[model samples]
Target: MRTYNIHEAKTHLSRLIEQALKGEGFLIAKAGKPLVKVTALGKPEASSTRRLGFMAGRMRVPDDFNRIGADEVRKLFEDDA
Candidate 1:
């Protein structure tokens, strides 16, 4: 854990970021007081690789899914007229 002043942090931002990405976190301070810590982030889950039917067997869709709520919705609006 190393502390860098504001000026040093600004001057070597890229290098600091690289170090953080390599798991070498550091602290940035201002006026000799610590302010923020830099660290690497965990890898993100990939959306493209996610399974689409993750709950396929856990749920079922009614055959009339789309039309199931049509009548009730239409009546609500009709009563407003």
Candidate 2:
């Protein structure tokens, strides 16, 4: 995809950032509308940098952390017993 405008995207701003870093996608009209869009900068689907108690002193359980239930966490994860 490609369109360009604003002065041909500022005189081909480095070939539209090398075709939006190679992933490709564009659009930037103006007097005709469709204002902006470039694309190719999306690689963080998700992540909370989790694990390890997920907080507080980073984890080192066994202080009876607390909150056990749901039938003692399904009998401490029993599979068939």
Candidate 3:
């Protein structure tokens, strides 16, 4: 963890950003009061990976999924109205 005054942080923003990229937490101060904290951004997680444990190998795909042509889809829309 590190702290920087407003002027110091403005003057050394690049260094602070480098530190944040390296996973260091930082606090910025304005008029000697803490104003902001900075941390590294997390990498986006995959939806499939997030579905693990509860979703372990339980997906289903019907053969009819590929057989549904555009004409059949249009019929579904016409029947719904």
Best by lDDT: 1
lDDT of 1 by residue, 36-61 (tens): 98899887778656789877799989
lDDT for predicted candidate 3 compared with the true structure: 0.85
lDDT leaderboard ranking = 1, 3, 2
Task: Indicate the residue-level lDDT of 64 in model 1.
Answer: 93
**Worst ten-residue run, lDDT, model 2?**
45-54
Off by over 4 Å in 1: 47-81
The pairs that clash in candidate 1 are none
Backbone clash count, each prediction separately: 0, 0, 0
Local accuracy of candidate 3 as per-residue lDDT tens digits, 1-81: 778998999999999999999999799988878999999888667763574476557877677887769787779889956
- Name the weakest run of 10 consecutive residues (lDDT summed) in model 1: 42-51
Looking at model 1, how many pairs of residues clash? Answer: 0
